[model samples]
Target: MNIKVFIYDDNLSRRDSLKALLELSPELEFAGEAINCSAAVQDMETCFPDVVLMDINMPVVDGIEGLKTIKQNFPHIKVLMQTVFDDSDKIFECIKNGASGYILKKDPPQRILQAIQEVYEGGAVMNPSIALKVLEYFKPQEQKSPLSEREQQVLQLLAQGLSYKMVADKLFLSFHTVNSHAKRIYEKLHVSSLGEAIAYYYKNLHQ
Candidate 1:
């Protein structure tokens, strides 16, 4: 099946240009176009495009709000934010609001095509700078574990980044017992990642 796409941008020239570039792919079909947020939403209902290429700045509602609206109303239609702004907050907010992908307006046409494909395949895309921003934002906020004394020993050895086998050997515990303790540690801490567990340990140092 052809990948149907809708373009939402106030600039007629940009919208047409994007359409022309994407038309090069036999697998992609231009479904429709909308100049502003309201029209975009209406067009989405009408066209039901599989993916939407949306600009950040529009005449009335702007891209972010339009993205939020589209995602809210048409949850299955993935919106790929096509904008000039590399601002971290904008990217983060877009993702938080259900944007499936983000790409700079200045990116090569090829990259935009790839982004659409990625979003269609259930993947999230973001500019490299935007990715770094997310990492920075989450780095400090990542959760840490609160293991008990014995659990802490198990985790500390694990934090040394030891493998389960090594931790089991060093702690002189059966591998099965060590695995059970690790599972409990993960549950008590409410953490899924080792980095979060490590950060948790430092945050509650007084404990």
Candidate 2:
């Protein structure tokens, strides 16, 4: 399906350029365009676009405020932020305001289109530099795992080279119960495989 896109930029030249780029890509459809997000909810309701390309700076209602409004009114619509300034504060503010993607105005047309498609398909997108800034901003906070005692026991046993059956026997649990505990452990640790779970266990142990 062609991804429906709406643009909200005050710059006529930038809006025109984006429209021209959309015209070239068969996978994208230019649903609508607006100078600012003054009528953001009304315009979005009118177009029902799958994704919105939003400019960070606008005349009256800025993109950050616009993003918050759009998300509040239409939580399902994905909004991708665009800006010339690579300011980390604005980028983080957009993210906190529920923007699905962030891109620089200097980014190539193809990258902008890719960001649209990605957000439309339920993926978040960000420019490399913006991503780095976001990472740095969030790197200071540590995420604590919410593993239960039994789940942690299961992970520790798995890390110690014990198979699920062996762990079950040692812990006096049924095989199915042990498997369930292992699954919960993997989920709490956010690891896909036993190896990753074991690695996480050892990494935390040393930390």
Candidate 3:
């Protein structure tokens, strides 16, 4: 079945160009178009499109507000944000507001069509440059686990429901050695019990 697409952009030329591009694809149907998203709720109700191509920087009602309005009123519909700017703040805003994909307006027509189909089929799409920026934003937020490799091994065995004796037998270590490792693991993780240590392993250390 062809996926129906709607457009929300203030530029007549851009909207027209997009409509023409959609017509080139046998798998896509151009449901409708709009000047801006000031009447986003009503416009969405009228089109009921499977996907929306939203220009991110309209004059009055920008794409971020329109994206939020669409998601609130019609959570099932997928919205794809298109913009000339690679502004990280707006990219984050659209994502937070439930945009299914983000792409540059300068992207090739084929990429845009592919993005529309992808979002319709329940996949999130991002332009490669945009994806790199997203990765860069989160790079500094990843925390390194402080547990040593051997301690992590002990924790992994414990997480797999092994007792201290069983862990010692598997690793060919003394039971006291496994017990001592368990105590150090708990101290390093700031967890008190075996269950707590196992939970921390799953939450932060297990990889």
Off by over 4 Å in 2: 141-207
All candidates in order of lDDT, best leading: 3, 2, 1
Best by TM-score: 3
Q: lDDT value for candidate 3?
A: 0.91
> Model 2: how far is 33 from its true place, Å?
0.8
- Name model 1 segments beyond 4 Å from true: 141-207
Clashes of each: 1, 0, 0
lDDT score for candidate 2 against the true structure = 0.90
- How close is every model to the real structure, measured as TM-score? 0.67, 0.68, 0.68
Residue pairs with colliding backbones in model 3 are none
List model 2 lDDT by residue over 92-121, tens digit each. 888888999999999998899889989988
lDDT of 1 by residue, 1-207 (tens): 989999989898998899898789888899998888877667887898999998988887888888888888889999999888788878888888999988888888888888988999899998787778788888866445456777888877777779889988998988998888888887888988777766766666435
- The collision pairs in model 1 are 144-200
The lDDT of each candidate is: 0.84, 0.90, 0.91
Model 3: number of clashes?
Answer: 0
The runs of at least 3 residues in candidate 3 whose Cα sits more than 4 Å from the true structure, single-residue gaps closed, are: 141-207
